[model samples]
Target: MTAAQFKSNRFDLAVDTISRADLEEVIAWLRKYPRLTMGEESKRFEQAWSKWLGVKYSVMCNSGASANLLMYAALESAGRAGKRKVVVPATGWVTDIAPAIQFGWQPIMCESDPVTFGLNMDSLAKILKRDHPENVVLVHVLGVPVNMTRLLALQKQYGFNIIEDCCASHGSRHQGRLVGTFGLISVFSFYYGHHMSTVEGGMLCTNDEHIYHHLLMLRSHGWLKDLPAADARRIMKKYRVDPFHAPFTFTIPGFNLRPTEISARTGSIQLRKLDATIRRRVANHLIYQKRLNGAVDFARGIPGDVISSISFCAVAKSAAQRRKIIETLDKKRIDTRIFTAGNLGRHPFWADRFGVFSAPVADKLYRGGFFLPNNQSLQGTDIEYICGVVRKALE
Candidate 1:
């Protein structure tokens, strides 16, 4: 049901979780499919996502984290098997950096633009000129697509690979192109509270033939039997066959990261509703922009880029005030989340292990930022009520 149909008392945050429909799909798939989890549903999910994102190929893994690993593994599988350095923006989900660390690739950290909250172009240039990593993990922070036109131009000059991190971005576009398409390999998260979900899933997309096949092998046991690709013969020759075929073939070093059939079906159902979901989120965002003129402070720095409204993000003037806002909203049954990872590098996870440090732009975002209850099902009145609560909170 639409939020407008509910009673005014229901103004508080609707449950921050996936829909019943998603649950039902997963259940139904389990009942119908003999193998509760396998490769078929994953295969279908990949095809659907490719069509949705306008990419030629996709690889589905058990989780978004695994997808990132496969994206890098595919590169390593293609014989770039050295300490490949990857330049990445400092701000993003923790898992965004997981693959680089796991695969022995060095991560050259860059900063984010306070404005777009994507890559800070100036900092990126400095790193590109100095460190010159073989890759860049361009994160589309909070669904704001990076300045791809300029970044791609630089890519040509520098000749490094791009891995678009779409963990928080689903329907985002940059210069009329989908955010995930710019990178040599794009990665997405289907985690709960994202644009879509399969409980927990992720996808890797690309048009490259070798990378595509390598990813297929990398997701499973890195074996020929597990991955039934059209280019299996080519892989056999490339990996030197060990003279074994079909029934038993371990062509390359691989991992058993296959996703479940149930999860895949759930994701497929969710995928069907993606465009509509995106529209609802876009509409709700417009409502906030129009009505919440003076209710609360904004990040005020985004580069006027069209964001997918991954979250209804804002920056309250004071932490105490933000706390009060959350308290009030919670009393009203409303839910809220802190802004993106809250200065991610400051956490011990990065500092102790990677020797990473924080930056000025990220530190500020940490102290004042938060994301409100937002999703495709949210309606105009729901938005109005949310903004109303924010106005009340500010007062």
Candidate 2:
């Protein structure tokens, strides 16, 4: 914890996943075609992402938050706003919940499962029984896939639309299939600290063609130009507009959330390395689990679920122990963080409007959850050292 410790190279929670070669690849693309914007490169990246995730369509956007916004907006546009309520997990980034509320949808906060750090079925069942919400924003919290088998069954019974927030989960799988493919629409973040990097970008993936067409329009300025020629023509024919005016036509209200050619080009290069990056992350996570076994309390994927492990998490038995552990790790030159925005409902933004609802599991996470470094850069030795620090702190 001393100043000298700070000067040393610590096992930080995130190392830049984007390599120099990836940057050079982007530069090469730019140099080859200097006129860069969200065009061919963006389309190429979107196609690659769709193929990787096994989805019919993928739309690249400026950030994950924008992806969420467009997803919710697409739902609202599809006329689900009448139900007005959506179930959200207690543990996840604010953006996951914010866009829902911003779109005038009521957010029913559900408690987290200590095992998955996602919406616990018990709590979610209770919410579903009570509210019968038409939508559920499911976050694969920190790359640990939710109990999708159970959740999907519930979804079938309840008839709620599912939006999988895979913003932090690039390669995570549930039931042997990718996480994003399970829901109607899924999002992924390629920010600097995520599983991969586009410097700043995100993606929305879906199998639904209508949603896909809407997403294409929504990512841009809600114009017909981004849509498929047939789809755009249909809209034009319906509105009685000429081709000249079609370029300037605005359909649904939207924002320009498009990513640049640079981001997309960089993402295309980064995508090539994603599998290796995920393998290293899994390796480090296993090391953390083996080393920190019995000392920490956090979720791990079951047999059919695979975690990308953006950062390995450890939950202390008590709030005091959690604080001590964080301070101790800092002294040892290790980086730690609260698990992904811990209990979005506990934050002032939601609490002020909703009047402080209680979610025991999320509250437990808010008080005790902390993350350890787990990324492509971390070696087995580094993971061992970090775990040793954690063990000492717990002691």
Q: What are the per-residue Cα lDDT tens digits for candidate 1 across 1-395?
A: 23542633444333334667667766666676456667677778889999999999988887888887787788888875344898767778777777777766788777767666667888888888998788888778777678888788888898788888888788877767777888889988888778888777888999987788788777778776655544776667776664456536766798988778877888888888888878777677768767776776453334445567667767677788788888887876666778877666777767878665677667666777777756765778777877888888777
- Candidate 2 local lDDT, 56-96, one digit each (tens): 99999999999989889888775655577888888988888
Residue runs of model 2 more than 4 Å from their true location after superposition:
1-8, 80-82
* Candidate 2 local distance difference test against the native: 0.85
Best by lDDT: 2
TM-score of every prediction relative to native? 0.89, 0.96
Residue pairs clashing, model 2: 1-331
- State, as a TM-score between 0 and 1, how close model 2 is to the true structure: 0.96
